[model samples]
Each structure stands twice: as structure tokens, then as C-alpha cells.
Target: MRLRALLTTAALLAASACGATPDAPAKTTLTWWDHYDSGAADQAVTALIARYQGAHPDVEVKRTAIPPAEFRAKLDQAAASGAFPDVVAVDSPDLPRLVAQNAVADLTDRFQGWAVGEALLEPVRESARHGGRFYGVPLRSETLALVYDREVLAGAAPPRTWDDLRATAKALTRDGRAGLCFAGLPEEDLTSTFLAFLWQAGGDLDTVDDEAGVEALAFVDELVNVDRSVPAAALGWDNAQVAREFAAGRCAMMVNGPRVVQVLNQAGMNWSVTALPSGAGGSASPLGGETWVIGKGSRHADAAWELLKSLAENRDNITEFGAGLGALPNRGDTVQDLAWQWDPNVAAFAAQMPEARPRNGYGTKYPQVSEAVWTMVQQVLKGDREPEEAAAEARAKIEPLLRER
Candidate 1:
């Protein structure tokens, strides 16, 4: 309640200062669109906007928060209509396509002197860049990890290797808990998990015939069909559902991000997180984050850039935003801050951040490719196809998409 009151006060002050200043140049109104769907995350973003507005009274940012499911479709429609917002918080994976289609502006020049832009962790920066140019600024980042009930795994260590993971999960599968579970429902969520698995097996999207692809799928198949360790309900669950189940004690262990840590802390559940189990490729994870971009049709690009530059220069904004959302810091410098260095879970995740990999290939057709990957997982999970056959079919489906420029 106190925090909400503070935010409201901040917003009112920003709004009050937004009027024209006789001594300054004409005020510019910048339209900003964001898809921070969760309540706390959404609050953080709106507060950030208010802070920006308070500092730069000459620039009034009209912000809109969209539902995540509708964001892409709405943005695409707006882009086609030449009415895209001036500033946008875009999904990291979608930036490549937006840049390719000229829906977003290239930020290379604006990012040059910006310390935050320059100090962004490599994987976070890579998510916003393509073909030697930066198209967006890193917002926040997240990755899948082992979130476990500390009480449940009192004696057993969090899984370290594939063998350990499988054995531990099977051993823990009792007492009304599924042992191990994760989201594998559809589209991005399922595909993101698959990317982590694929990379762990030492395979990447470019190679269709890589044996590792089948190996990874086979492992997941064993967990579901053979070992019966993960509940069949997980096959239809999404990330939120997976987190809730873990928090509710429906599962002893879950593969999810740190965003749920705050809820776990509130619920007073004895929980801890560790790096995802290492495989043949060692520790590797799929990356996810939001990127701030200037839309192609933005008339107030200068004002938009100013807003972005302010956000980059303000490290506190980044840190506070990440803390509010339970997301990882997107910049290397921020990771070194004393606020994060002492937190055990954040420190553990920081150790793995360097090894994180972008889930989407650096291309415009990633959505199609990801759909293919998830489809294969669904087919294999249903026992409708062998891992080898499913992987081959998946690769075949995505080959054409990858070949697109």
C-alpha cells in the first residue's frame, strides 16, 4: 500500500510538471507502448515512465501497457498502418523481425555514448542487435532454472548433471508431488524450454541433422513417458501455471525463472534455485528479456531517444525495475552493484548469466521456427512419434523459415 501510494504520488508530480514551460522549447509528446503483463512488472514500468516524465518535463510520454498475448499482433497491425508508437518495449526475440521489416529504428548511434547500452551483458545486447547493428536497448532479462522446495530436497542436492537430474527427479516422485515439472504448452514458452535442451545437447538451430537434437528430445521423452516422473498435466501447462504448481507444492521441483521468487518469499515457502542441469554442452540456458526500441514511424524520434538515453544513464531505474519484476539485471555493471552481489539466488543466477544463449536464431522468421520446435515436443510428449522422427520433422518444418532473409 505504501509503495502504491508512492508511485501514485510520483505519477501526479510527473503529470503536474508536464505542462508547457515558457523558458523552454515546445514540449514533445512521445507515445510509448509496453507489454509488461504482470502486475508488479507493469507497475515498475509505469513508475519508470513517471520518473522519466518528472525529470524531463519538456517531454510528455503517453504510455500504454498491453496484454502480452495481444502485443505482437497489435504492434504489427500498428506498424502496417504506419501508426506505431514512438517508443516500445518489445520482446527480445521479436526485435530481429521488427528490424528486418523496418518497423523499429536502429539505435546504434544513440547507443554510442550511453553507458548502460555499452555495458549491457553480451547475450542481452545480442538479443537487440542484428547484422552488425543495434536496434534496441536492453530492458530486463530472465532464464529458466531449477526452482525447488528446499524442505523437499533437504538431503538431495539440486540436479547438477543429466544423470543426476533424471535420478533425483525419479527418486523424488512421491508424496503427492510430481517430482519435476515445467511448462511445455505451446508457442514461445515450450519452444524456449526446447532451445535450452537443444543447446545443452550441443545442438543449434542452424544444423538440422545434429544428433544432439534427438538426444535432447529423447531425454524429455524418458522423463514423461518412460519414467513417468513429470505429470502429464505439465504437457498442457504454461510458465505461470508451472510456477503456481511449484509454489502450491503440487511439484517438488520446477523449471522456471526468478520472477516467482518474490511470491515464494511471500508465501513463506522454503525455496531455492540453481542453474539448470548441465548436459554434454555444460551449463547453457535460453535467454528472455524486453528491449526498448523506437518505432519506424515515430515522428518524435529525438524525444524518444532522449527518453531512452535517460533510462540508460539511470542505473537505479534498471536495478529497481529488475528488483520489482524479480528479473535479472540486463547490464554487466548493474550486476556488480552491492544490492545484487549479496543475494545468494541472484548470485547463483549471475554465475550462469554469462553462458545464456538467445533462443531465437538471429533472423526474422523465428516465430515459425519456434512453432516447429514446440510442435515436435508436443508430438513426442503425446507418444505419437519417436524423438528421432519428431526432430527430423521439426527440422524439416523450420528449414524453409530459416532460409528466409
Candidate 2:
């Protein structure tokens, strides 16, 4: 037996929250599955596991970490074989799909009543919702921002709007260094970057073919094609590669997340983070995060919930955990915590959270929708079609998918 001895209070709460039986599970070992097992973040997870085990002598936690690429397939296999873990961490966007399939226990009422829920960031909370019910608790959250070299800028101020950003990129381009760089991979990497511009132009994912979207696409196209400020090779680059380029001084500025701080620091680079320049509308960026969910049919459902509550509600735990995990804290209390306010690397992210929104509006079958976005970006960057033409083609591709999903 790994987990045992639920109090009457917790048992009642669990029953109400997830319909978990009050009766004790015959097996006591509860498995926690996630998709991180390397570096500082994984070390934090290990420490968290140790702390939980020490506090509750009877409940033994078995932690399993898999690569992100293999996570979905492995989880699917477990679901089919009825061998799901007690607790699992999944990306926020996947929450809807998991809930729709009834693969995870619902935690709506329990979560809203949880102590930590009060200060939860609105965008973070929204990421955990699906069909009007909450199915997960935010384990980590992140958003994109402008990362730049203070020295490289040579006393120039960071740009605040699209026009200024374009001018800055052009002016900073010199001496073998590109002025700005970003991931242009034909996937979610590209979709997120473009979505920021799309929303900043007062366009939504559903309206990708609208005039605003075309303007956003055209702006990026100009940066790459006419301005020649962004590297052409960006077309084949992903987020990691773009960050690397920035840290190496191949680019003076990058659109990246807080995690880039670690890489830049390790490489002995001086960099500062700021919110990305807005379009005509105002500040807008995409949010990304992982959420903690209880697997359906797990015998240790109550125990899993208990563990989740302990980690999520504790300010010290989540703040430290997010630091190691390359995740920014998702609650106002944590974001406003003195440590975060003093930390330059993450403060920009904290400030940007209120304006950040979930990518593609949290709709089901988002991969297809994002594919249309990817096509639009790639076609424009490759110079094979104008921004308007690409957006129109993308709209044609997505109209049927919108209906199907």
C-alpha cells in the first residue's frame, strides 16, 4: 500500500469533487506522470516528491517522466489498457480534449473553492476550462516577450509599437548581426508568434482572412523580405533555434519566453526582457502552460487531489517550482511576490500575463486551425504568395475544419 488514511473531511470533499469513493484503495502507491525529467525543473519535481512523501509517510509516490513527443501516445496506451496514473500533467490546450473524452476527473467546484484559486490569473484559469467546467489546475504558465541585448542596442530604447519595432529592427541591423529574429517553423511555433501580431491587429484566429490579419502578415513579411532585418533562415527555425541565435549575438532582439534567460545567462550574454511591441490595437500575446489533472478511474483519486492541492496552493512551492521549470507563476500573489518583482528576467512575463490569451481561442481540434495559420505564415515568408493571398488560402483550408471540429 502506497497511499492511505484519508480523513472524513477529505473523503467527503473528494466524493463531492470527483465522486471518489470513501473506501480506501487496496493499493497505496500512487503514480504521478509528467513530461519533464531533465535539468533544474525535473530536480524540483524530485524534491517536491520527496517533500510530499515525507509529510505523508503512508502515501508512496512513484514518479515517471517521459519526453513530450512520446507523452500523448504513452498516455493513450495507458488509457486503453486501464493503466492510467493517479495524476498526470498535460498542456492547458489538451485539457479540453481530455475532458471531452472523460479521461480526467472534473475539479470545477473543488478548484474554485481551493485557497489558491482566489489569486489565480484570469488567463491561467481560462486555460483550464472546457465546456464550462474546470478539469485541471495550472502547474506552470508562460508567455512570449521581447528579449533584447541592452549593450547591443547601443543605448536605443526598446520599441513599443509595430512601426517602432520595424524601424528598430532595421536600424539595429549591422556588422553581420540581424536586428531581429523569431521562429518561423511551419507549426505551433509559427502560429503563436503570428497570433500575437494577429490579435494586436484586432483580428482573431477565426478571422485570419480578414484585413487585419493580412496587415499583420504583411508586417512580418516586410521585416523578412523588404527590410531584410530578420534572417531568411528563420523560415526553417523553431523557438529553440531562434533563442540560440539571439544568445549568440546573431540577432539583437528575439521574441521569446522567460526560459531564454537560462540559455542567455549560461552563454554569458547580457539581455533584458520586455513586452513585445503591439500592433494598432494594443498589447497581445499567446499564453502557454501545463496543468495538473487527475486521471479517470484512478483508485487514488482523493490522494492525488490532496497532493495536487498541496503543491499548487503553497506560494513557496509553486514559485520555486516554476523557477526551476522555466514557468512563470500563474497567480497574482506569486507574480506580485517580492522575489518576482525584483527579478528582471521574469518581471516582463508577469506584467504580460494580464494581456496574454490562449492560442487559437482554446477550441477543440486546434491543430488543424493552427495548420492554416502555419500555412499562411510560411507562404508569405517564402515569398511564394502575398499575405492576402496566403490568408485567403488558409481560410479556405480552415473553413471545413471549423465545421468538422
Q: For candidate 1, write residues 256-316 as lDDT tens digits.
A: 8878777677777888889999889777888887788998778888888888877767766
C-alpha lDDT values of all predictions: 0.81, 0.82
Count clashing residue pairs per candidate.
0, 3
Error of 2 at 122 (Å): 0.9
Q: Which stretches of candidate 1 lie over 4 Å from their true place?
A: 1-25, 341-344
Clashing pairs in 2: 2-28, 2-29, 3-28
In terms of lDDT, model 1 sits at 0.81
Over the stretch 205-224, how does candidate 2's per-residue lDDT look in tens digits? 66688989899999999999
Can you list the residue pairs that collide in candidate 1?
none
